[model samples]
Structures are given as structure tokens and as C-alpha cells.
Target: MERKQTAELTNLVMVYDDNGNVLVEEKVGSNYRGLIFPGGHVEPGEAFVDSAIREIQEETGLNIKNVKLCGVKNWVEFDGSRYIVFLYKTNKFSGELTSSDEGRVFWMPLEKLRKAENKLWHMDQMLELSCGNTYSELYFNRNDSAIKPILK
Candidate 1:
């Protein structure tokens, strides 16, 4: 059997404050639009945590540190290649918040985000993973598109 290789790698980070607010991006791009965490694709040969820190800085103007790996989201593409997203969370960050071309960056209460209607597709599940409620998310694209969460 041929080995299934990962075709893409990405990262998502949930930056939170002590007052129960989490950093969010109101994405303006063509893909993954709506309210989401600050994150992006991992550059070639970059370390996973390094990629997360870099992406957060690029997207939200925050220099994050002490990032903790909370979970992951993965799926098989149509061509049988795999795509993966490493989910990370941290409260340690510095710098003034600013928005990039990707979206507007702001802090929102966790409960408010939970009830928000403008979240990206399957963002709740991703939130779950980032909040340490789950450890893995598997997207199945059979006849019906379904996301299954694997608890930690």
C-alpha cells in the first residue's frame, strides 16, 4: 500500500487573556471567512510551534509565547493526501493588537464567541479542540460531510 502523505500543514492559535477574553480575527478572505482565531499556513521547513507564533504575529500583531498544543484537525483530500491543522492555545503574548490583510483582530468573551453566529464553518468544533475539550477532529467527506470529534 502506498503511504498517505500530508499535502498541507496549518496552525491555529487561541490567544486568551486573564479576563476570559480570547483573540479573534474577523477574516475578510475568500476562504474560511467569518470570525476565527488568528492562524495560517506553516511555511516550508518551519517548526510547528514556530509556525503558530509567526502566524499569530503576522495576522494579529501579537508576539505569542508559551503556546500549548491543544489538539489537531485533519482530513483526507480527494486525491487521498492528508491535510492537518495544529491547534494551539496560549495566554502569553505581547504587543499592541492590530489587524492584517487577513482580518480584524480583537478580543471577545469566550461565551460571546460561543454564541456568535458569524463563526467560520465548524468553528465550534475547532474551539472545542483549542479549549482542551477535545484532542482531535476528523473530517469525513463521504456522501455526507461530517466532522467527528475525538475527545482527549
Candidate 2:
């Protein structure tokens, strides 16, 4: 018999600077690699926005404000576990970028992220969804490689 679907919460933040460059991290995790935004799991009982802020600070050493919930993404693992991600974007931040064992953080042009050499996961879709005006959600069936937008 198939196992029941279990839900898990996570977060992803797109930090942009005054120069229009977005902060990308080279992930050290085995499951994911290459250039990606700086974010991670929300701590237990923490407010979603607070979690975003905390993850941003921990991963990038930046205190960010104007934390906007721009989008959401759902990834259904092969084991029937669901990972829900809250996507945030912010231009208002302070402090120097610091390195973390999670990844090396740096600023890069949006176009550079789109280039062929970059190994970001779903870079085009992710960029579009995060920059979208309205809040959105996307579901990806990791087992089958199927994806579609979802309603809240």
C-alpha cells in the first residue's frame, strides 16, 4: 500500500541589492546543487515571515526588511512527503555577506543566472514566480517530473 502524504514546511528568499543583482548560493547539500537562493527550513512554531527573516540572516548575514511573500512552491517527494516553500523577496537589507557551510553566497546579475552555465533548478520558472505581482503556488511531483500551479 502507498504511504499517506505528509506535509513539511520550508522557505526560500530572493535577496536583491540596489544594483539589481540577486544573491545566489552554491548549495552544499547533496540533494541540490549549483546556484540557488539563500533559504532553509522554518523553525518549529516560528511565524512564516519571521522564519524567512531568520533564515536570511543565518544564511547570508543580512538583516532584511520589507519581507514580502511573493510565492510558494510544493515539492512532492517520491516517499509521498510534501515540502512547502514560502518564497520571499526583499531589497531592504543591511550588513556584509558572510559565508556559511550551507553554501557560498554572492551577488550576480539576473541574466547571469539565466545563462546556460548556471545550474540553478528551474531558474526561469522560479524567477518568474518570485517576481510575479500576485502570490502564487506551484506543485512539482518529484517522482514523475510533473509540475503545475496550485490554488490556495
Best by lDDT: 1
- Error (Å) of candidate 2 at residue 54 is 0.6
Backbone clashes for every candidate come to 0, 0
RMSD of 2: 3.0
Which residue pairs clash within candidate 1?
none
- Candidates in order have lDDT scores of 0.86, 0.83
The candidate that wins on TM-score is: 1
Error (Å) of candidate 1 at residue 126 is: 1.1
Cα shift from native, residue 80, model 2 (Å): 2.1
* TM-score, every prediction: 0.91, 0.86
lDDT of 1 by residue, 92-151 (tens): 999989999888999999999999999985788888777755455646553356777775
Off by over 4 Å in 2: 1-5, 133-135, 150-152
- Candidate 2's C-alpha lDDT? 0.83
